[model samples]
Target: MKKGIVQVLCGEGRGKSACALGLAVKAAGSNKNIVVIQFLKGKNEETEIGRRLEPEIKVFSFEKSERPYCELSDEEKQEEAVNMRNGVNFAKKVLSTRDCDVLILDEILGLLDYGIIEPSDIQKLMEARDEDVDIIMTGIVFPEELNGCVDKISRIDTVDIKGV
Candidate 1:
């Protein structure tokens, strides 16, 4: 069977990365090469999962701050942009090899949301890849331009418990 295009998991609720990681696991089990680029900090669960995963999984982080776990400095922001570009570049290289069946740009939308990376660059990255390689994009926010490029989009809305 041929692979699917891009699937964007976005919104305010949690589990975006979790859902993406799950898909990666399934793909890896099927002997499909997979790469996951995480932008957010402290994805210990994912790291642990990747370690236990057989056939090995390509996962890496480009986090700015180890403390506060929420804020990012200007330098961190710059580093993130570089790392984001590098990840996409690496994916492009991998796509040329025709080895990988899936590539997950985890938290990519968040990078775009924070203006760490350009939307045009992302569009180009999608265009440069093989049509059969499946992509699972996870982030809290989705830009309008990106929304148009994606094949399917699923949003997770949040529920407020206490009304202050």
Candidate 2:
């Protein structure tokens, strides 16, 4: 049985999401479907660049506030938790339905770090996808518990916060 490669791009680096989006663009150029579900980030405003992706690469962010999930007040965090879970449910739906050729769960690692979801959720998410559907996850921290399940793990730690 064949299965799609699961890749994780993680660490304190800045380009993780960019790398995922670049891959999505490549997939889109090849006439393939791509879906991006962004978490942790709370940017409610959609940029012009994001809008340009169009029906080719669908980007979804369920966050309400412009503040990061970690920055929210206790009450706000509670509210965003529900929204984030909805995003996870939507991701599961996309995977089960084979709605896209590539699924990019941006900042999903942070979801684990924040306890919004468990390794079991990730395991289940992985199980839910079709064999040929690639999954790319980007975040600052990659949980060690999932090390063996994924096909590839790219640690994207930054060398320096200041330019050399």
Predicted candidate 2 versus true structure: per-residue lDDT over 1-164, tens digit per residue: 44679999988878998899999999899898889999988875542366579799999888888898878899999999899999999999999988999999999989888899998999999989888899999988888889876999998866864776
Best by TM-score: 2
Question: Highest lDDT: which candidate?
Answer: 2
Off by over 4 Å in 2: 1-3, 44-48, 161-163
**Least lDDT summed over 10 consecutive residues: which range in candidate 1?**
62-71
Clashing pairs in 2: none
lDDT of 1 by residue, 51-125 (tens): 565455688664434532245576765665676667667766766776578888887777676676788867877
Q: Residue 27 in model 2: shift from native, Å?
A: 0.8
Local distance difference test, candidate 2: 0.88
State how far residue 26 of model 1 sits from its true place (Å).
1.7
